[model samples]
Target chain A: MSTDLSVPVFTNQSEEELGGKWGMVIDQDLCTGCQACVAACSMENNIPFVGETDAAYGRSIQWIRIERFWQGSFPEVKMTPYQPMMCQQCHNAPCEPVCPVFASVHSASEDINLQVYNRCVGTRYCANNCPYQVRVFNWRDYADARVRPELVTLQNQLNPDVTVRRRGVMEKCTFCIQRIRHTEDVAKSEGREIRDGEVVPACAQACPADAIIFGRIDDPNSRVSQAGLASRGYHQLEELNLLPRVTYLKGESNNGSNG
Target chain B: MIKKFFDALNQPLGRVGLLIAALVVLSGAVWGIAQAQKPPEQPIQFPHKLHVGLGIQCLYCHPGALRGPSPGLPTESKCWGCHQQLQRFADPTTPWPTELQKLRDYVQQGKPIQWIPVAQVPDFVHFVHRPHIAAGLNCETCHGDVSKMTVYENPQVINMGWCLNCHRAKTEDNSQNNPTNDPAVSAMLAEKRTKLTDCSTCHY
Candidate 1:
């Protein structure tokens, strides 16, 4: 009998996840960095707009961002691909312990880091503690009369399932806990367990390249586990051992640029 | 004394503590008086006692309970459906009731009934009536006994804690088992139990 030792298994939240852990696997080679995931995540999560001035002052509220690394010096400069950076949802999350209000705790069921906006007291400790720099602080009350009327009109299109966070709060990627909850509710209503590919966060759903894959890593047959088992699978800042649920697959370099 | 009182009120740190205490007392008094007063004035007099006494199920008028997120107000046509034939009175020549006549005027004008909601949840809350209805709860669970009310008023205050109590308590009770043999409903009952305590269950 043949055996595969490379399968990454994780378990969390559902009754079916007896030993399950939720994780994600991203293929960098296939991603064009069009930023569909970034746009979709903001819309789905109801992330407030900080406007041009605040954005210029390094206060943009983008939950998922594309970090561009420019490789090489002057004459032979090249764009070393776009790395989509969001909350890692780490197993040994640095932000979890730092929270004074217990807002940034590891969700025992889903195996993901969660930030409850109601519980957050805006200490900025979680933001400082996060090695990936994915957490963002709500500097201003962006949803109310503080913003331009036109922008407030834009805010009307916010997702009803996610909170429009008030000022003095810290927020980050929750792996779309609302979506996770809704799907689980629907599934449990029907007398079945959550399927392998059933739960996909907004970022994974929006990517046109099909680069971002999110699923239960505990299931050996899941796409995320399969991708993690592949040769190119690697963790960012592995030495820090944050144990992030997000795993990146090395993209194939184009035209002999940096790998 | 007035000058000293003014000075005390003007002090920022001390003023806040006093102001909050005064506001709390003032608001609580205002709220108590308001609740003590008569019920809200509606465009039309919709007496739940008369309607419910006629053997009308709550779902007949507020059909959104099982189907949608809210127990929505009945449409104008639903009221008109009964009132159009209510032309004949005990005297056989008496015109419709004054309130019924106003209802007829609106229906004939092609205007919708803008019924004022009695139980209004805050904007931050996304309360849905479906799960509560599915849990085999009657209209009286959150909405006190409406059949006994002549004038509709909020009998119970609906806050996060009020909802949390039911959501947390129902799992242990499990008294509201769905009669349907459908597999999905059973799954929902199983899955929805733990999710009741989740924040996004109502807030999101």
Candidate 2:
């Protein structure tokens, strides 16, 4: 029997060739490693506070984390610029393939990797497969008020736009798909295209230094596209050929000699 | 004990008892599912038929449907706004209906009516009503004909399959649907189909 070529299949094509819809640019030079983005992301996404014990064990469900490296050694030691790490929204995400349930699937329309909570069977295969190590699994019912009595009062602040994920589901940065969808809906209702800087993710919005930029990367006029074109701009782990949507601008090292 | 249990299954009378027990469990499961599907009892048992028949638009009660995800329930004042002005409630000699009395009590007590939503999708499904309404869908399309019923009920099970069915139908390319056969229109429809079918569109 002849193969039906009309049927759609997943391809490992690079996002640069396909042109991603949503993209982010984080300026490492401007980031202060304050962790505001992490806090904002948790509140906006309804990510539970896994407590000190779980967090110490590396069970904290932070969608965005700041990575700080040390520059030089001993006497001349200095802190390197802070780099914010998150799900790169890769066009050919490594996590997408390993999910047997297809819970970690790519959205063709949005061009972003999605973690379908209801579909996830807690296999944690996607988390292990991810090169970025951005995916966090719900080790317990952290958001459930019945399990966590203190969360009952905090539940009032939960964002209704984003789903409160339960135990066993592996989740990661969605690039604020809810905000993107809301902006798209509003733009559609007004019979216009989404304007530049119209859809900002929680991390980008909460950045005090204005280090993070988010917008349609396909549009050359967008802020994210312009930032991505900077000479210092580079993707984390670019050698992997994941085609990460996040572009990080290199920051100048502050060695002791500079002081 | 295990061998004795197996031995009892060998007898005809024991087999009949086992069959009866299995049937009871199967019927109980079926009944449980049916009970879950039944419409939940609302606090007011608000008469949709009378209000809809009176020519009041659905948007008047649920203005949020046109603007956001939730179609907010009308406040007690909104209900009292019309009820207090009504000729039936105006006359001291006439008594208010039980449902209207509940509304008056709520308004007087300064408490909000805790309305139980009928057509609700799970938390994972981020359903927004504005887009559906903007797509030229009438109130009765998904919510059924409120004009005919007293209490609101779902027209169909609000599941992924039901949603996908409508999305597929709307996005499908048909000669009858698109008589002009314009390339630009077809391209737009194709793009829309992708957006509508994409998992992230509904489930964030």
Candidate 3:
């Protein structure tokens, strides 16, 4: 709510310690790009579908998706699905600085960058500023009962903590803050500290191969922090100095390719 | 203020206007109260008292309440688990014998009963019942008392402001933390203001 109308980019050591920098370590070597995480995230977060044609035009509202990179072509093709791309929770975020309405902002207690839907006027400046191409816009209200009758019964299954967005707004992953809050609440009620790895995002939980590890990055002892600091760990566009919370493990290679 | 007062009296029907205004306001209040109490008629009148009182917990009928986003309503087969033989009764005084009829139709045709949703949240919230349940939050924390009511009603006006208030209050007390904060931990907390305003926490 500043007069400058610019989204504030913040990082607090205290909040980083409490909530911690919730980073994800995705091991691409273990990923098959089967799109299970994509489907699970959609169901868990109530992400509306954009249908086949819009999806073809790159307008699909997938919070997490397989980014395919082809090294060769035809029968000689070497196609690899690199990783699931999402908001990096950047330390020096280009998207945060560019948002005129400050709809995209980060908090000290939250390592996950937040998008204030009520404040968003759909300028899409944040989307344009983002290098990861993870933010999705709701071109239409496709998740509602009128557009998808089959989802009518299942629609109520949507996580109540996360809002089901209407058309014309933008949305992306928030590391399932609702679940985090719930875990925090339970921990407090029991008069115990919230242990690391107690809370996991839906995709991390649903990953068949367990390729995703979500935890505190501030705690050097935490698993996510250890994996994030690994030699093979690298951020997408790390050269830009976004310092994204999401880290990727290099895909493994075998004799099948060279031999 | 004087000009406006004289303008009303100038019409010579000021008393009549006041009476009409009073009548409208009185009727409006009555209508508002009635609307608040009225429950929408659903496709099926699900007997909560019978099911819940028969030692069937909410989780029994709502099997997915623990793990999934939604709480699944009971299926016809679930009802037939007990009602198959009960349907053969010839007693004329049964309160709702048609309940069995609806079950029979559903089982024979695989038609889903259109039960009305009593509780609803706004579009922007990311609430989950499992976490709340797991957190030891009682059913009545936000749901009010449901066991006493015959028909479900909108007991809580769940809005953004409502949720935000609770979240705000939660930040004040650090009772959820370890009972004994280590010297190093206290020092770290004192050094920085926690960021509670992150968008990714709620949006995603």
Can you write out model 2's per-residue Cα lDDT over A24-129, one digit (the tens) per residue?
Answer: 9998888989999999999899989999889999999989999987877799877778889999998779998789999999998989999999999999999899
Fnat of each candidate: 0.22, 0.86, 0.73
Off by over 4 Å in 3: A1-20, A72-77, A251-259, B1-121, B126-204
Q: Give lDDT: candidate 2, residue A59.
A: 96
Stretches of candidate 1 above 4 Å error?
A: A1-21, A252-259, B1-41, B85-93, B172-194
Count backbone overlaps in model 1. 16
Report per-prediction Cα RMSD to one decimal: 8.1, 2.9, 8.4
Q: How much is the lDDT of residue B71 in candidate 1?
A: 81
Comparing 2 with 3 on DockQ, the higher-scoring candidate is 2
- The candidate scoring highest on TM-score is 2
iRMSD for every model? 3.2, 0.6, 4.2
**What lDDT would candidate 1 get against the real structure?**
0.78
Q: TM-score each candidate.
A: 0.77, 0.94, 0.60
Order the candidates by TM-score, highest first — what do you get?
Answer: 2, 1, 3
Misplaced by over 4 Å in model 2 are: A1-15, A251-259
**Complex DockQ per candidate:** 0.26, 0.88, 0.34
